[model samples]
Target: MKLKFLFFAISFLTAIHVFSQNTYVFLGSYNKNKEAESIQVFQLDTLNGKLTKITAAKNVINPSYLTVSPNGKYVYACTETKTPNDGNVSSFEFNPENKSLTFLNKQKSGGENPVYVSVHKSGKWLVNANYTEGSVSVHPLLENGKIDSLAQNFQYSDGSINKERQTRSHVHSAVFSPQFDYLFLPDLGADKIRCYGFDETKKQPLTETKNPFTKTDLEAGPRHFTFHPNQKFGYCIEEMAGAISVYQYENGALQKIQRINTHSDKIKEGFESSDIHISPDGKFLYATNRGKENNIAIFSIDENGLLTNIGYQSTLGKHPRIFALDESGKFLIATNVISGNVIVFKRNQITGLLKKVGKEVKMENVSCVQIKKI
Candidate 1:
């Protein structure tokens, strides 16, 4: 009887592993002058948190930021450029059958140094944010998974308190609201979160909303923004100040509710916050901080959307530019740009803590990480 019971338990666990969906992860790197493949694809074993290389997408110039379509059939990247008004965005067809990417076409990004790109939920519009010139560009997605000409290009002129980093407007990210009715442009150099109404049904998809925009602290340098799963609150991670600002969002407007630091007071100087994300369950939030304190700050979100600091974990590498959690919320991957390595961590689901899984991949200046079920 005991032998039969043990056999049944092993069979049950094996069935669960076989039924789980296979996960695919894409890594983007800062490949200057096309020295290496800009994007690399890997397969992640959900049961054991193992990452195996699958393939790579080559010849993409500085494809620093990547976003997939709603259907996951296409992939888009921001081709970070140096020349003013010369940045471009590229589109690729993702072949799931063989796990390969084929280049489709590219479009001008309106401004230089395109740092961020996001696809609209409808999969009809692609929004890009240019950092060097502080501009936002919108493009229509063609039916063939390519990009149309620039639909709108809005330039910002204001500068904030930080003279070195905020000499002029520096639009960092373009994120859509929960319902897709509004878009938020976080400007690091202007100290403002610009809001706009989106209507893809019209000739022009984006228009300035009635509320216009909202302001952050004098030198907050709002870099990235994320909305809660409940859609009642929003959070902005400040790049220059190493802080997270909470807001009550409604009808394209933001009301600042609370602000919390991503790092402790002991490490006062040289704080450069990079990215922020919420867990799949929406109970936990994570933000990355660079500089002397190279770690990820973890927090728990209360019922009212307020945050309570929990703990911090070392990234096991330098300059963790960005990190993302898998769909199952079982694993987390971080791209260490300065160290040129990608590290994976196993997540404790109930306690919301991270443990290094002893897996790392060496690449050239890794910058971004994206995981999707294939």
Candidate 2:
């Protein structure tokens, strides 16, 4: 009787461990050909930082970027990119039981080269930034998970100092404030971070804020923006300038606090800094740099919301356009677009450093990586 009771207790604990591991990694890629998989889902092994392929969404065209709905029931992607005026935002219904994604519907993205898509926390609004057209499109999401037609389209007609890349407004990303009350658009070509007031209750949910925009350094082409978990600070990764602009946040307004370089002094030219993200604990921040300098810059966040450079980790691949930290902040996965691979790194929570682990996934032109516990 004693032996049987011990066996039952061990089995119960093992079952709980298996059931608690629910994190998933979603990867988006540029589908150069029809036969290629544009979006793939993998189940992450939390113990070893290994990713196992679960499924892939079918018939997705150039899903270069992806965002999962707040409820984890749906996913949306920027599709048909680089297709002239045919860029689109596609929606998919995610079935966790079967671990599959079903195509729902798509809507015209309102501009060209739709590169980034973000869903509001309320799950009622969706926004996408057009990289080539330098515009933003707002859409209302239906209760059934389909995206409605465009509700509002805001276009920018300004350029910065760089005559080549900053010839016109190139909005790289659209990010929502932690409170979900505001939307921030980082325009790489305009050298400005545009702000908009977001109201979920309105038919047209986005309106220009009183302080409409914050200007960065002349050639600091801001690409991606992320807010700290504390909600008091925001960071923008500037692609052209290869620096991160830190700002103090309050009520939809940002005050520049610091501007730090993402690379060492020796590496100056060809700076293509990309993604930026804060850890779940809000203790550290990471930014990825592409181009000739391919690495993830690490920084420690102080109580006053400023960053101190800690160390840098090599991504072990080329052109890491995007990377994501797991919900637990235990693992980070980076997608190397040019090298056609995805590498996983085990994050040291105490020191906030990363060590590469597990075999890399050989994929072609993967542009984005996002992780969620569903």
lDDT of each residue in 161-224, candidate 2, tens digit only? 8989999999999999999999999999999999999999999989878989999999999999
What is the TM-score (0 to 1) of candidate 1?
0.93
Candidate 2: 10-residue stretch with minimal lDDT: 30-39
At residue 311, give the lDDT of candidate 1.
94
* Backbone steric clashes in candidate 2, count: 0
228 Cα displacement, candidate 2 (Å): 1.1
In model 2, what lDDT does residue 90 have? 92
Candidate 1's displacement at residue 131, Å, is 0.6
Say which candidate scores most in TM-score.
2
lDDT of each: 0.89, 0.92
TM-score of each: 0.93, 0.94
